[model samples]
Target: MSNLNLSFACWDYDRIQALTNGTVQAKGIDLNWLNMPVEETFWRMMRHQEFDISELSLSSYLIAKDRGYPNFTAIPVFMSRFFRHSGIYINKHSGIEEAVDLKGKRVGIPEYQLTACLWIRGILHHDYGVHPSEMNWYTGGQEAPGRVEKIKLTLPPDINIQPINDEQTLNQMLESGDIDALIAPRAPSCFLNGSPHVQRLFPDYVSVEKDYYERTGIFPIMHVVAIKDEILEEHPWVATNLYQAFVEAKQKVYDGFNQTAALKVTLPWFVSEWENTRQLMGEDFWPYGLEKNRKTLEAAVTYSYNQGMIKNRLNMEDLFAQSTLEAYTL
Candidate 1:
């Protein structure tokens, strides 16, 4: 049988590098992989459907599915997972001493519906009784000006969301104390360049994240692998084939991290770090299937629904291809 030719787009993360380098390949498929920044990848996929398969923002994917707009179907392969506590930066002069202090404060965000912000907002509400409607939201680009939300949003009446002035960026606003805090996937430039005024809301973010994970078991999923629905319909087998290929690719990265002979990567404590992670997160720490990630998925769905990004709550069966939901074992 001849292999089907398909285009896939994603960032050049080490786990997915094997697929890009031809070490791991989907069975009966010839993949044209494009390594690009995540923003451009998601923008191209969401705006033009440029690729047959690509990594998409989890929040945007849920929005697309809820509205039945994009003709795409997702798999259980989560391309990105991040704990977002470290992503929140605050102005040192602001009186925001704790999560509860965010109430009535002004916060800047790159986009209101970003997955990281959604997770942070949900965490604040659940942990500190600070709801989304409690704070004023300003949205714009972090570094440059004139960024807009990728998807349309119809939020609740009480929610305060406004765009920043064209003259300023979120980072500038954060540094000037125009906004009390900022929540984003990447730290603002002011925070990155050691501006004395900008610091993480939780200075001890590592400990907070570890304790939060222990309490909730949610390592917040950020992105998911999606395929055009037409492609899935034309070749149903492509679903499981691609899923298995991604699993194999991730295993290669794991194996490299665990090699004890010499450091495979640049990190001096690579093996020790791997051992510590294994003890905390178990052997297959970064799992890619539905069952192993049910709690995480459920939390994301609830957050999206609560934040008004998705009109309805969706389940795993609704979001992922059925063929890739479970793996057979010996």
Candidate 2:
């Protein structure tokens, strides 16, 4: 039988380097790997089904699945995981000294349904006394003009979300103090450019993130690997094949962390950092399968549902291919 040829679109992260460099091969398949910006890749795949497999935003994927878009099915491969507390930026003059101070203020977001924003909101509401209904939300592009939410949202009646004018970006509003705060995956240009007025809501974000993770056991999933529904239906074996390849590809990156003879990484404390991270997050810090990530996945599903991104509370099992749910141990 001829190997199935497929196009796979994703960011060229170090962990997935093996897949892009052709060192890791998907079993019984020939992959055309395309390295591109995540937004372009997601837009092309969601709007036109441009690739047979692609990395998709977790929140957008849930919204798409709930709305019956019928384009893709996700796998347990979480390509991006992040702690979003540090993503919340506040105006120093807004009088918001803490997360609780965010109440009754106007906040800006790139989109209401962005996975990073969802996690931020969830943390704010759950950990602190602040609720989504307590503040007004403004949505638009962060640094660029005219970005829109890819999926429609059905926010709670008490919640308020307004879109900014096409002429203005969230960065301008944040810097000018038009918005009290902003929650976005990428820092707005004002903060990145060293504006004294722009600062993280949680100045001690590292400690806060560590405390939150220790309490909740969630590393917050940002993106998942999705396969075209049509391709998946016709070629069921492709799911497991791709999953295994991704696992091996990520393993190659993990193995490089311990290479200390000549310093595998440029950082002087690369090995020390790795050891400290392992101590804090465990040996398999960035696990990819269903079993290891069930708690985090469940929290994300709950957050998505609570935030009105999904019509139904979905079980994590229903989101991924059944064949890839469990590993075949040796």
The TM-score measured for candidate 1 stands at: 0.98
Off by over 4 Å in 2: 326-330
Clashes of 1: 0
Q: Ten-residue segment with the worst summed lDDT in candidate 1?
A: 321-330
Tens digit of per-residue lDDT, candidate 1, span 239-298: 999999999999999888766888888888777878887888889989888888989998
Clashing pairs in 2: none
User: Can you list the residue pairs that collide in candidate 1?
Assistant: none
Query: Model 2 lDDT vs. the true structure?
Result: 0.89
Each prediction's RMSD over C-alphas, in Å, is 1.2, 1.3
- Model 1 C-alpha lDDT versus the unseen true structure: 0.90
Per-model TM against the reference: 0.98, 0.97
Q: Per-residue lDDT tens digits of candidate 2, residues 287-306?
A: 98888898998888898888
Q: Can you tell me which runs of candidate 1 are displaced by over 4 Å?
A: 326-330
